[model samples]
Target: MNALPALPDSPGAYRWFYADVTAGEYSAVFIFMVGSLFSPRYSARVKRGALPLEHCAVNFALYHRGVSRRWVLSEYPQASVLRQGRELRIGRSRLEYAPDGTVRMEVDERCAPLGKAVRARLVLEPQVPAAEELQLVPGLPHFWRALAPRAKARLDVLSEDVSVEGIGYHDGNHGAELLGARLPRWHWARVHGPEETVVDYHLPDGVAPLRVTAGVLGTKSERRPLLSEARPTSLTGWGLRVPAQLYSGNTVVGTPRLLESSPFYARVEARRDGLDVMGEVADFRRFHSPFIRWMAHFRTRVERAA
Candidate 1:
């Protein structure tokens, strides 16, 4: 496996895997608290399989507005490795792999600025005859493609309210010794009472072109574009409520609830601004690899205000 290109530590977002076997759905979501430089959070869940299982995860990423601190709890099972060093905080925790093959995880963000807890359990029985190998995209970058079919997201965040852009790629062998390789960036916004969502993402071609693919996901009743046609929207939300994020310790989580007409249902709240993000997921999946460890090395400070 080759090494993945370095992702800027300044501001970015990522996701974990959770297949709902109990609900007979394929479900997963990614959060992009892009440091409020672009406040964003993405969620998605799909129902397709027969046997039902909840896809769950507990993960968090830490970054200071202007401080040079960066740390994240990635990877699961065995000793939960804590990737920290370069101006960042860190820790290590273990997970509970159920006898039924369900994956349960717990992440605690303490003594830090921003913290969160996520719980996801994906159950895939593979009962139905295998569909034409729906081209499984390996690596962290392109993994979202697998979930794209059942995905419906709202990007209401960007550098500014201009046409946002991004791309998604797929690859069988992304040369990632530890994980798969993928690169994507987009802008999104909500329309009319937040009932409608739109996004524009870019997936560059070159390294893993074919393995790399891009598409847009929308409401179940509507047809989403496999490739975007309109420019991405620059949507922003999260007023003052944004704080230096942190995660740590025992927390409470409510049963995942599906938002009306939305693809996401689970919600976990940890401490954000001296207040607790109540009902936040506590245990989800995480990955610890060389790239993640490198990223965990430093803290990123927010840009200075004029």
Candidate 2:
């Protein structure tokens, strides 16, 4: 409906970072984030001169064959300062940003809960210039910046010395604000085609009074707005929906196949207007606290979507 909001003048005031890598029919998602709320409760605490309240969390997940192994660490660090940077470290794992605009990531097996040791080292190189920062709300309080929408990745992963090397797709996002506070629900998907990459976000009526859809198509020489109509369809097991098609006016441009589905997300392989698509889409509601979901008037049960 309405045009997306302008960029926030002070995006640096908050803290967040996310990086995702997918290769050889498997994918990894990593996130480091700090969220602050300035609600009446927080304001009252501030009036009483209480310490600032915030939440910090780190999440790393690996997905393959309808199975996911995730490590989540969350805490409320009282009187601790939160900072944002190109480098992030949690436990034995680390993600670093290099001078050449590449991101290097290393994860230790100790972070995983069970099974043999799983270790990884990956280098992500951007294939196109960064997309313009997009402000999701009117004040740009929270935004999504697609870095390396299409990337070439070199990865070496070992599970008890068994190693695999392959190329993959890389993308990232940085934002400020409690996601649940900003929108009730949304669907996001990225397609890494042979010659290009396409990314899309669909904010349904629950996220806002009006439906909002935004996306980008990235090629070797340029990144442009995706003028096609894209939406999720074909509900699979566990209620996961796949990105059914991309359309230019009334003409179909692409179609996608469900590759994997979990409790709150799904990965797909798509063919869009002659370009191949491989990516994932997620619904955050499933990840929220049970109480929060009840308060938000949304209902979800924890189940294996695979």
Candidate 3:
């Protein structure tokens, strides 16, 4: 089991646990966030010297046949979040890990703008062992780890009659300072096969890229791109360019289809090839714009404690 690690408590420090699972015709992704890296509220409050835990949040999305079925991005106050080594709870939802490498996620959240319920229960069993943590930037406190690069997952939506089983992934990132304050943009992709998984992350400022391959044998990671190859791709409606096709090593993974798009970020998936890619062009820098911060409110929901 991979328990939650010690989190930083300074203002603007952030921590988050992210997981995604893809099954036949259905897929889902969820995250538990402290400091809420993408939160407009966090961005504003941190400037005022507020604690990172004060802006915690839970984000979950369910998809069917490549279309978004239910989306939730609910932010909570510091009083509503509870963190422990083996468990972390936000509102009525929680994430728990067992000694046998089983991870269970309980989600009871609501869609933004409207308060519609989006409840789900997901179970993930790690098939491949956890990998080591790597520092992203030099002299920076930010770090990332692929806790479970490969896992067997099952999902059930409690709000409706839905259940499925398939491949899944779990990872985490923690930092003592704001992510955008150090990096301008990044691109990341994960390609999976029956037994092996590959993760490629691109960073700016000449920092080395993180490429990892994990399976039963062990975990192998590279810090640099194999060669100077940047393939051409198209631009999103929001002006963010993304990779149309993903490559790991010398193998052509597959073409990607856009799942979500924004002025600073893009999420694409090559479901046929068993992989997904997420990219951020200028999220933090543009986030400083007043107009951009106002736009973010529409994508988030704020629920008061009962």
Name the top lDDT candidate: 3
- For candidate 2, the per-residue lDDT at 21 reads 63
**Candidate 1 wrongly placed segments (more than 4 Å):** 1-58, 61-92, 111-228, 235-306
The best candidate in terms of TM-score: 3
Per-residue C-alpha lDDT of model 2 across residues 104-206, encoded as one tens digit per residue: 7676533422334457676777767666666554453555666566667765665423233333444444444334444444555555545555565555442
Q: Can you write out model 3's per-residue Cα lDDT over 62-122, one digit (the tens) per residue?
A: 8787688788888887533344478888777788887777988888988886868888988
lDDT of 1: 0.21
What is the lDDT ranking, best to worst?
3, 2, 1
* Higher-TM-score candidate of 2 and 3: 3
What's the C-alpha lDDT at position 122 in model 3? Answer: 85
Q: What is the lDDT of residue 79 in candidate 3?
A: 30
Give candidate 2's root-mean-square deviation (CA, Å).
8.7
Q: Rank the candidates by TM-score, best first.
A: 3, 2, 1
The C-alpha lDDT values of all candidates are 0.21, 0.47, 0.77
